[model samples]
Target: MSKHNDQIAELLTDDSFVRWINGDANTLEQRKWNRWLEEDPANIAVVRQAKKLNELLWFEEEQPNTQKELKRLESALIEERTLPSEGINRGGMGMALWTKVAAAIVLLITVVGVIRYAHWGPKEPEATEQPIMATTQTGYGEVKRVTFFDGSKIILNANSKLTYPKTHQGGDMQVELQGEAYFNIAHKSGQEQRLFSVLTAEGKVAVLGTKFNVNTHSEGTEVVLEEGKVKVQKTNPKDRANKPYIMSPGELAMLFSNKSNIKIQNVDSELYTSWKNFELKFKNTPLHRIADRIEEIYGVEVEFSNKSLREIEFSGSAPNKNFEVLLEGLRTLLKIPVTYEGNTIIFGS
Candidate 1:
């Protein structure tokens, strides 16, 4: 018991051992502990016990019964130590060692418990008000139409998710979007005109009765207005002081997350909004953009072995309802090598 007490005291006094147990060890301290374990494998049980004790003391909501837990831990350590080592029975030595370690284990538990109680203790969780949210998700190659109580309609494209409040109490009709979706926001006139905002990872699109197509991708969020008007704002912290970009009919707004500016352009609305009709219309669209759409819809990674293959443009319409049909058309029209390896679609042999 005195021997065990001496070992525990020595380890507690060692800053490296204490830091390692507390998971605060730097790279050098971690290497030091690893070397100690490799040099003396017998110390593994002590290290594990110290880690478990620390976890039980800190993460546990209710105070643990120190006496009972200590006894169980002591028994586990004794059993682990007594196991046969190197084809020889070390049961007798393990029992004697554990008996010597009992007092040391108790001292460690007492000291750690006192410190924990003095500095940190379980806290009562504060109550938080949470809004009731309703979410709609579409799987790969599947399109879904969601209708809201205010007669607003949203057509979610494949592999997209939309979350909004279950009911509108009338401040701002806000919803969050991930992936691509086409919006036909209901027109509100007079005092009933509430701003309809679509939140995305890149930015927010605020509209008052408009038809638009929004696609969220790795680069950022793209918004193409079919009719009416919409305001686009980038969520970048540096651009927070800047005013939102306004878009009119036949205008496309791109909100880049990494950049502090929003890009607005005039584009053919059909090129972006035709997907809702189970087809995709491309007009001199680059292969990389097509690959982005394919990846976004089918949830498959598209890679081009040749960098120049991504620059090739395609001008045609393809059936988007069937993924294989679209890939077949791409292969036939492009006359390039398209191969499927697991979930990845590789172009150029």
Candidate 2:
């Protein structure tokens, strides 16, 4: 092959060129792509050779183990590249040296191909090293009271998921949570000391076996302390070290996503944990926001066609009756007729 032909062959065999063929062509600019394809007719032949090699290696009856195959190929390439001494016979020695050099070139190409394939090929499934803990899920309009082996009690609200280990690990009690839950953790007395933690999407709450309630959804996360004290820290730290804020009883830790800021204030603990009793309490909460919470608790869809009603603020408690009855009460309070259609509730004229 000519020098230009050799260069074309090398480019065609490149892993990047293979990636372009394997569905990454969009990454190349239009002009560069056109120039590459128009380089030479021999380039097409080189591409075909690469494609054939790829098919032969990947489509065989049973593909070999990638690591083992690469290791064997490397050993063979090393043996093929070992040249004889200069003192050897000139005739056969020259032929042997050329053979070794040619073999070395081929081996180099194969090694490059192997490395690229190992990186871009179908990955092997990795075995899970740790066993998952027991998980509990609460459906819509449902609530569950769970008692852990360590004597901690958790009340999971509607559409909530809680996962905890079957057996308590020494030193700490940890539980992963999604949605809303009220926890009444029992204290453990020992020289080693015991810690309790609740893990959520926003962060993790660590306590010395205290009572707390955690409410988390797409909007944000809220931590309320009913008894004892707790420390809140971001699970995935943005800075090099995490900053934890401690909250005493009757305090609330509100984490908002817009500014990624945490606000701590004294709050009425009953307002936070009232959902456990099926009572909805709102303190200056927007009508639309209340509707959203009602929908989540009842597994229904709420639509406020009258956009004006969304700006209204509601403050009071509603009974834990069925959704229809609750809507009837709201209708009386707001002086607007609420209509229910299947699973959708609409607020309109």
Top candidate on TM-score is 1
Candidate 2 structure quality by residue, lDDT tens digits, 1-349: 5775666567666777667656566556445655776897766766676666655666437766999868877886666445333211112213344334433433443312211111112333542123246666554555678887667789887666677766544545567777789999888787646677887766778877888999887756799999988888765476545578899999999765443557889998987888877677878778898788876665668888888989788778876544545676777766677888866788867
Q: What is the C-alpha lDDT of each candidate?
A: 0.73, 0.68
TM-score for all models, in order of appearance: 0.60, 0.59
**Counted clashes in each candidate structure:** 1, 0
Please, what are the lDDT tens digits per residue for candidate 1 over residues 1-349? 5775567567877888999887899999999988988988768876776666556666537877999878877875775455332211112213234323432332333212111111012323431223366666555555778877778889988656677777556545678887788999999888787788888877788888989999987788999999998888776546456578889889888887677678888899999999898787889999998998877666668999999989889898887656666777777777788887776899997
The 10-residue segment of model 2 with minimum total lDDT is: 111-120
Q: What value does the lDDT take at residue 10 in candidate 2?
A: 73
Against the true structure, candidate 2 reaches a TM-score of: 0.59
